[model samples]
Target: MINFTLDQWYGWINAFLWPFARLLAMFSVAPVFGESTAPSIPKVGLAAVIAMVVAPTLPPFPALATSSYEGLLVLAQQVFIGMALGFVIRICFSAVQTAGDFVGLQMGLSLATLYDPSTHSNTEVLARLFNILAMLVFLVFNGHLLMLDVLIRSFTALPIGHASLNPAAWMGLAELGGKIFSSGLLLALPLIAALLTLNISLGILNRAAPQLSAFSVGFPIMLISGVLLLTVVLPHTPSYLNEFYQEMLGHMARIADTFAAPRGGAN
Candidate 1:
């Protein structure tokens, strides 16, 4: 008969629980998995499945303590690491939404808000539309799988209890945040520039004929031009989204490297 001591059982359970808790925390805030619309039971089940697959591949943990407090601390650490990784991807998606919001504002559609089920908040219609489009493109480009692969590889690169948020990593994440504005501005530039020229022309026309109400005439013109510009720009959006996704992946990889690197060296 196999003889397992109490300590041995505690160790076994701790080993499993550590990674499981971490994976659960990760999925809890991850993009699709974290969405408000996702059913909780399924999300928890998925986390368990992931933890089981990944636990054996993880680095060995220190001897488990019988105290529940130690286990909770371990669980908290894992949750933090998972949340940081998931947040990086979430920021990337925010870039697309940011661009959409800007476009909506420029096109005078800022007031058109819709209920976003995923977030359970009201967001600009254009932002929601672009977010959906970006998601589809993300799937088409195999980005979802790539992200999962990255998350898995992160364990090997920056193993649990080994990872730390370095200054360089924080700087890189900050830089990544800046890209949201840059990408959004880039996506909205054409429309903005076109509108500027159209408004200037309308101003000149109004000056030449005071009888014409610029509000009436220019409003429709602006709307039509904006719609036309969007139609023309629609085909190019996938390319932009693809580039954004690639950049996000690269940024995440760099962050992982920073975390994996020796502490207090060049970032």
Candidate 2:
């Protein structure tokens, strides 16, 4: 008969639980896994499954009781690490949404809003459309699988109980968030420039003929021209979104670098 002491049982239980906690924290907030529309129970189940698979192979886990003070601190650190990793990907996905927002505003479609289950709030229609497209592209690139690979590898790069996150790395995340405005502007640039020139021409025409209501006539023309310009630009958006995704993954690794241990694995 195999005899297991109380401490060994505790260690075994905790080994599975600790990494499970981190996985939950991550998937709960990370993109499609965390989308407001997704039910919570499935996310928990998925995390549990991954933990079971991953726990056995992990290096010896710290024997910290889930209820103790030290254990609480460790739990908090794991959550922090999870949020940091998930947020990096969220920032990347936001780039497309940001671009769509600019295009919508320029096209006078700002008033067209939809209830976005992903956010549980009203979002611009164009942003939502772009979000759908980005999702499709993400799947095409096998990003979901890549994310799972990264999660497993993170144990090696940022093993349990060895958490020590550097604060300086947050600056990098802030910079990532800031990319929304600049990149969005770049995405919408062709339309914005074209619209500006159109508006100028309309202004000159209005000056030449005061009787015609320039506002009424220019609105339809701008709308039509914006549609044309959007069609012209649509072909190029996939490449831009692809590049942004790559950048997001790079930054994700960099931000976590502050907290991750030096270990070799899929990340």
Q: Whose lDDT is greatest here?
A: 2
Error of 2 at 108 (Å): 0.8
Query: Candidate 2 regions off by >4 Å?
Result: 1-3, 261-267
Residue-wise C-alpha lDDT for candidate 1, range 1-267, written one tens digit per residue? 999998888878776777777677767776676777889999889878877888887887767574667666666777776777677777766887888898888777899899998878999998998888887898899987787778778877777666455657766667777877888788778877887888899999999999999988887788788889989988898988888888787777777778677778736
Tens-digit per-residue lDDT, 1-267, candidate 2: 999987787787778788888888878777778787789899899999999999989887787776788777877888877887888778766877887788788777889899998888899988898888888888788777777777677877777888456666665667678877777788778878888888899899999998988898988888899889878888777887778777777777666665652333213
- CA RMSD of all predictions: 2.1, 3.4
- lDDT, each prediction: 0.78, 0.79
Candidate 1 residue 217 C-alpha distance from true site, Å = 2.0
Clashing pairs in 2: 157-261
- Clashes (backbone N, CA, C under 3 Å), per candidate, total 0, 1
Point out the worst 10-residue segment of candidate 2 by lDDT: 258-267
